[model samples]
Target: MKKDQLYREDYFTCPIYFMDKPEWVKKLNKASDLYIKKAQKNNQPNIKERTKKFGNKGDHGMVHHSTSLINDPKFIDLQEWILATAYNLLDEQGFDLKGYQLFLTEMWVQEFSHLGGGHHTLHTHWNGHMSGFYFLKGSERTSCPVFEDPRPGRQMNLLPEKDKSKVSLATSQIHYKVKPGRLIFFNSYMPHLYTVDNGYEPFRFIHWNIQAIPKGVLNINKE
Candidate 1:
């Protein structure tokens, strides 16, 4: 008699990182609040206006552009950890990042005060290799981030759920509940959306876009 072993393969997995730094979380929230106050005083335009075409609807929402928190001394430690984790993730995905350097192209904060309904529709970060979110203030009742399936032709073949005993394989979207000090990272091409806020407290998060390039690469501008 002969016996054979069966193996299951999983592909196209998204990675999530959870940060447990309480001090950094407080600093991030404080910085965002201060920036918002300054912007409001100066009458700075809200990002929601510019992103109207992208379907962002919230009661009170504002975005601060090009706010490089990574350079701030208060967030330097967290920044370093993020970069190291990025490289490690790449390595785990079978990409050798030895000769490449990772850099944050854009970093911004989104603050929302949801009294009733607030959400951001599905969208992807253009021209970005990787994108992530760091939750500064969140709770169980806060809106969660949902990611849709990226593969094409998934809708063409619909199968019935015959076996309830096994894990349900009909899921095309996944959501993560918001929690303080939780960070999530995913491919920039993945379409994701923010659900409506059900909690009484405000929701705040820092979003960042990252890119990896060959070492010593430079660009010259045209006259």
Candidate 2:
């Protein structure tokens, strides 16, 4: 006889994992601090207006600056590690990435200060094939990551028994708490928003963007 099970389909929002590299994590934290200090000293713009397109639903602090990895030694190292980690996860998940191009673009630093909570929004990275973020540092009150509703009102069509089980309700868009060293990946189009941060004191966090370029469109071949 077969063992009993409720459902066999192990659905997930996306492939996400926490990379275990203590030294690298430390290095990233240090680098983030340096960047934050520099940003504080510069004439940073009012992020409230700049981040409007990304999401303006809640209160959040953000600092934006773009630079190439080749120009920054610290960022170069972080970029390499991120790519390696992403590649390894995709391999384990049996994702076919042949003839694909990987491009690291739009690198920036974001700092969430006191009562700096984020709104429900998604990053609109043009032609972004795959994107994600690495939490350099965060307080216990960090915001939660919420997945958008993929299918609405579809649950009503299910049979009475299926509706009564509450499985579908649970599967409907879920929320995840952000933590240090935790990296989450998702399709560029997926809608996501950050919930309110609870801690009273100021907090800090840094994240960057990763883009993938399909091989055929680009003139160069994969290295």
TM-score of every model versus the real structure: 0.75, 0.65
Per-residue lDDT tens digits of candidate 2, residues 146-196?
Answer: 665444454455434445335354454556655566666655555566666
What is the lDDT of every predicted structure here?
0.69, 0.56
Any idea what lDDT model 2 has? 0.56
Worst 10 residues of 2 by lDDT: 62-71
lDDT per residue for candidate 1 within 155-192, as digits (tens), equals: 46766656634535566677777877888878778889
Candidate 1 lDDT for residue 90: 70
Top model number, TM-score: 1
Q: Which stretches of candidate 1 lie over 4 Å from their true place?
A: 1-7, 39-70, 156-167, 219-223
The residue pairs that clash in candidate 2, if any, are: 59-117
